[model samples]
Target: MHLFRGPGFVAGFSDRADGSLDFSDRTPEEAGRLWAGLPAVAGLGLPPPRFAHQVHSTTLLRVGADAPAGRQGQADALMTSVPAMPIGVFTADCLPVLVVAGEAVMAVHAGWKGTRQDITGRSIAALAEATGVSPARMQVFMGPCIGSCCLELGEEVVEEFRATDPGSLACFARGARWHLDLRGLNVIQCLERGVARAAIRHVNDCTKCLSDRYFSYRQMRGRHGTQFSFIARLPEEGAPSSGAA
Candidate 1:
């Protein structure tokens, strides 16, 4: 029931039924059904969405009805102006980004690598350029992620974030060993992209800290179920008026 949206579309990531994605094993169909049920869970009653390969880079793909199936391309973000196309991205600890302006929308997976590479900024720029959404009007929602508390990193990675954003130190603490604040850094990056501060909504839930209500790559150590978050442009006139829970 944790959902976030912008001016045009809605999206959310799911925790396991018990409110945790900390599972050792699960079938692909099991995962599929869980995602397919999102809209109903939200009260929209729509089916699941199409997803991209998510290479953790800054490549943003413009998706429409014609987009190919099974990994739209080697990209970390996907955008669409077409209503109901439902672009989506999957992740355990990576950031799930949903951006919207009127009817044009985008979904992105911004991992530390993607954040360092400026994926959020790049994808937002692409959305504006392709759909003519003024930055002043665009809104971005940064979903749950591995906060700095649990996202420990080596000096090399620490230096990468610091270099990309010197101000990000506020989010990182000198952990017992390394430093990290993947989410804070991403929020700084979002503000840098010209998105209005008032337009950005952040979900404070941390996947790693609130393990029972989220999926955490760090907590699971690579053997975890993945959850998908998605967004799709709704028709301006005839779209269903019923809101999802």
Candidate 2:
């Protein structure tokens, strides 16, 4: 249970360790459900997290009790200002981001497809619409994912990135295939779109490299589980005990 506590909320991604916090299961969606039901996460003051049926598109949904009711939504990103309503993103090699700003919290999923669609930038825009929190004032966490060291891309993906985010060209190294730096590309997009450099923090762990600590789709040839990353406003009434337990 890796964690990040911003000013008004607790946010983090579940690790791959075998225990109550282990969010991985047979499928990514199932893993999301399992982690949301964990006792420790419940103590953070929320019902089961609302997860997106990610399709690697640019769709971002604003969710809560008032907005949606089930785990059957289809979007790559979700934002909410409602307390006790947890929002999450499931990922294996893809990037999972949790953003906190004022009272608005968001969880985003971004693989090469979603990244090309600029989902992270849209998430910031969505939060800005709800509050005055700009990128500089927001606290953002980029969870563990496939890093530059292992994200080799084919020509099709390379051209897609080039067509969508021209700046993405800066995040690649040539080899047998293009060794792309997805994390760097997203951080670049955020900074270019207005996010302060210091406000963004990356977990910096490579899923493919850390085989014992995380599931990696590329490492496993597309057959692997996933990790859930979430963020929400901490319940002010009875906050759970938190620390290096």
- lDDT by residue (tens digit), candidate 1, 110-160: 887897777888878778888888767887777778876777778887787
TM-score of each: 0.83, 0.86
Tens-place lDDT per residue, model 2, 196-240, is 899898899998999678888888887556777888787544566
How close is each model in CA RMSD to the real structure? Answer: 4.3, 4.6
Looking at model 2, report the run of 10 residues with the lowest lDDT sum. Answer: 18-27
What TM-score would you give candidate 1 relative to the actual structure?
A: 0.83
Off by over 4 Å in 2: 18-33, 36-42, 67-70, 236-245
Best model number under lDDT = 2
Candidate 2: residue 147 Cα off by (Å): 0.9
Q: What is the lDDT of candidate 1?
A: 0.70
